[model samples]
Target: MMTYQEAMDFINHIPHIGKRNGVNRVRPLLEKLGNPQQHLRFVHVAGTNGKGSTVAMTASVLRQAGLRVGMFISPYVEDFRERIQLDGQWISKEDLAEEVSTLAPLFRQLQQEDRAVTEFEFDTAMALHYFARKKCDMVVLEVGMGGKLDATNCIDAPDVSAIASISFDHTQYLGNTLAEIAGEKAGIIKMGSRVAIYPKEPEEAMEVIRKVCRQNSIQPNLPDLSQLEILSCGGEGSVIRYKGKQLHIPLLGEHQIYNALTVCAIFEELNAGGWDFDWETIQKGIGQARFEGRQEVICREPLCLVDGAHNPDGVDSLCRTIDRFFAGKQVTVVMGMLEDKDYAYGLSQLAQRASRFIAATPQDTPRALPAGKAAEIAKSYCQRVEAVDDPAQAAFLAKSQAGAEDVVIACGSLYMIGYAKQGFLREE
Candidate 1:
């Protein structure tokens, strides 16, 4: 058996098979593995943002209902194994190594045929195989990118296909317009699958989702946002009333409350289909849910926060959270971004409230925006700007610049935010 490190190396070193137009490559691989995904029930989730939080909330509720839940997410914040989880617990290194060893010969054969799977495809296959082997009651699978062609979409019609708040992020892969992006996300909504949608999505996106639902003969479930009332909200968390039931959401930001509402809509569809998880169970599950690197507070003494808000919509959400929780505080912002994202728009939004900006490049990504280039962009919006090549040093510098009461926030690519989180914790 391969050691965990060797397994990781093997998976990482695998060459990307040229991208296909559909799930054609992944389907064949899974078929060779006896179609492990066919034996599993899935709650397929897709969107530009909030999909990870939604998946966590859904899996948490399922676990609360006494089900062995599997969660599959991509672009892991801290650990690589965070991509595959069961009952909120990450998959063991032993299991990952064993699975890699078992799949090695097949992978080698595919390589020999020049049909090697990409890293994400391989990860999706491993997650499906692991979940099936463990006999999970349900799996909450988050799309790696667009839903229609994402490897995770290889699964058959899911039990519940949830489309979170749609926005523009992956313009090259998904589409440019909101309608087109929504169409991609709505691809997860298959015939005979109950659908749940985030209520606060743009009308154009909602129209696309509604049309897709109509095509599938499914009436999409949406939370009554008019009925959602925030009882209290701060850095710690928020308490909100939805559909006349008070629910405490532990995840920070108003956007997260909307995400929880999407989870509620999901549970509504599940209950309507006789899943039997009541509102109380959902509330408990939501209250217990915690996600890292999204408005995550790592240090309280210097008030340092890390958020993975790369796109315009996500940056808007992060700004709103900052205004709500740290209003009037002198904000020192540490920002990093990928080259392909709408970083200019994101930096412009943050600049409106930021007292100073430290630009850093996200680690481990070929697409990272250079610290100097990001700083140059920030200079147009803010008078105070500095380029820091290292994300951890940027976090430390942001904290050092802040006073006891000043707010220090690191926002940008999730890749950098993970390093920022580690650095911020060290400051504490």
Candidate 2:
């Protein structure tokens, strides 16, 4: 009887698969496990950013509507089991241990046959098996990477699929151009399933998605951003008028408005598909949804904010939020990112909104860019740049240097945000 942590460690050590865009490995692996994913309804979500937030909001709404829902998101911010949750509760430790132990024999068999799988694949299989055993009404599945071959794409057909804001991230794996990237995300749009996309999607990306919808005979619905009227935005939340009614969501940034719209469009598609729910349920669910790493405020007096905005588009949105909400206030940014990310552009954009900068690295990640490298890049765009290898220490330093009205923001990679969150949460 291994403990839950032991089970996760075992899964971690099974095999290392680079985020190579391929479903070849995961499909056969799931097939061997009896394809539990085949029996469940799915709302498959895929995007460079906002995938987790959109799925979280959708799951929250569905849960509020009184349905048993399962949720799967990746690169967990706080804990390992946080990635797979059912009805707002994480997979119980006992269940995780038991499930992993039961899967041990299969893992060995696969290894012996030279078919060892990645941790993401194994996690996806375990989540599907657990969900099937519990018989959830449906699952909001977030794609780990490019939609085409992501392990989560093993589901036979989704009830609905969503493509949130597509942007320039994962260029190493997804391609340089937006069209190439959108084409990859459009891979999740299987025939017969409805899909909703961001209203202001790049023209090239929209063309790619429209082509896929045409190929699949899916008349994909696009959320009309123009219909959304934002009434007010603050650290507390955003109020917007949609369909002539005010809706409030307790999340930060204007970009989240579009994410909400994407969810609303999905709800409409689901309603059309015979899932009985209404706008009130959608509002309650969205308002209740809370994501840990994006615009999560851990402190109040001397504000400390953390966000998982490591790319150009994400950084741009964060900057907009800071400008809109924290105007006339000095802000110090503590940042870290993966070496492969477009940190030059990301850091420069962040520099525009920041009064000072502290560079740090996401502890323990193989892809973490060195803090010294980030400091060097910040030097080009910022007058005040300091390097700290430890993310927690960087956060503390920012807090110590801040005034009562000044803010401390930690942004870059989710792992970096996670590490800072652990440090801050520990103090509270």
Candidate 3:
């Protein structure tokens, strides 16, 4: 049997379980394990974006409600341990190792029995087992990809299903249209489950969500847009209306108001179901919750801003926030992206807000845009664009060129932000 570290190292070698769609692999594994997932309650979250932040907020609120909550989030910013949390803290390394070792034999036996589970399937099962062992009152599970056939969707109906914001992403696996993407996200909505959706004012995405809810006989609670008022939106942060109270979220970006509203709506649904929570607790949770790599500010000396804006709309939002707060400030932008993403669209959006652009590619799976190629795309929007394959070196160069008052914005992929934090911010 492999040690936990050894098992994690081994799993890393198995390419991510993304390209393949469907719960075919996880279903049988759950059956073999007696479906530990069934014993646990879930708050399943799925959407094109904001789902992670929404999960964070929901878990915080649930914790505030005095429930033992287990959160399983993916695409870790720093450590694999960050992906799993209990009572709002990262699962201890010793416990993480113990859990992995305890489950290793079962996973191996299943493989020997000719059940070749993907890495995600194994991780999903591990999360279920860990949550069940801890007897968590509820598990906040974020879908790895689309909702319908995602490995995380194998569990029984969640207590509440929440869809953050829907948009066009993963076009190859999901359809290429907003409606098609919305349908994939909407798959998590079970019959009779009360759903809280971020007010997707956009016509196309909302239409698909409405159609799915109507078909499944699910009651969709669309956010009352009229009630959500952005009191302050900029570097200082955003203030919004929630459950008839004005709340301020520490996270930057106006789009975060949508994330906050989603959390408020979910909490409202849970409250109506007999969970008692005061607005003060909700405010504390919102203010304290952190979502790394999305408009994350790491250094004030250089005024560096790191964000994981990999798509058109994401970059647009980042650019809008940058303009709103850092307007008239000469900004040095460090950028990188996966090759499959709309690199041209993202680059164009940031190019307009940047004084200088440094493009790089971190260690990522298939489709990491080569720095040279990313720079080529960036050049269409700016003349001061440079390509460096090493993300750390790129951040250093951007900072070296930046003036005292100039802002350094790392806009592209989360990998870039992770690299920047690990490599450059550590010394600072």
**What is the TM-score ranking, best to worst?**
1, 2, 3
Give lDDT: candidate 1, residue 79: 89
Model 2 TM-score is: 0.96
Work out how many backbone clashes candidate 2 has. 0
Q: Candidate 2, clashing residue pairs? A: none
Model 1, 300-416: lDDT tens digits are 868888899999889999988988888888998999999888888988888767898999999998989999999888888898999999999888878876799889999999989
Model 2 poorest ten-residue lDDT run: 14-23
Q: What tens-digit string does per-residue lDDT give for candidate 2 at 286-368?
A: 99998889998898768888999988888888989898989889899999988888888888888767789989998767989
Q: Say which prediction, candidate 1 or candidate 3, comes out ahead on TM-score.
A: 1
lDDT per residue as tens, model 3, 1-428: 45667867866764465446547777876776678887898888998778888998888878877889999998777677788899888887677777777766776787788777778877788788788889999899999888988889887778778988877788898898888888888888887667888876468888988888898777777778887667788775788775578898888888888888888888777776666778888888887778788888777767877888887778877888887888899888888898778888888888767778888886655668888888888888887998888787778777766788889987777766788665456553
Off by over 4 Å in 3: 364-366
Which lDDT value does model 1 have at 311? 93
All models: lDDT? 0.88, 0.87, 0.80
Deviation from native of the Cα of residue 113 in model 1, angstroms: 2.7
RMSD of each: 1.4, 1.6, 1.9
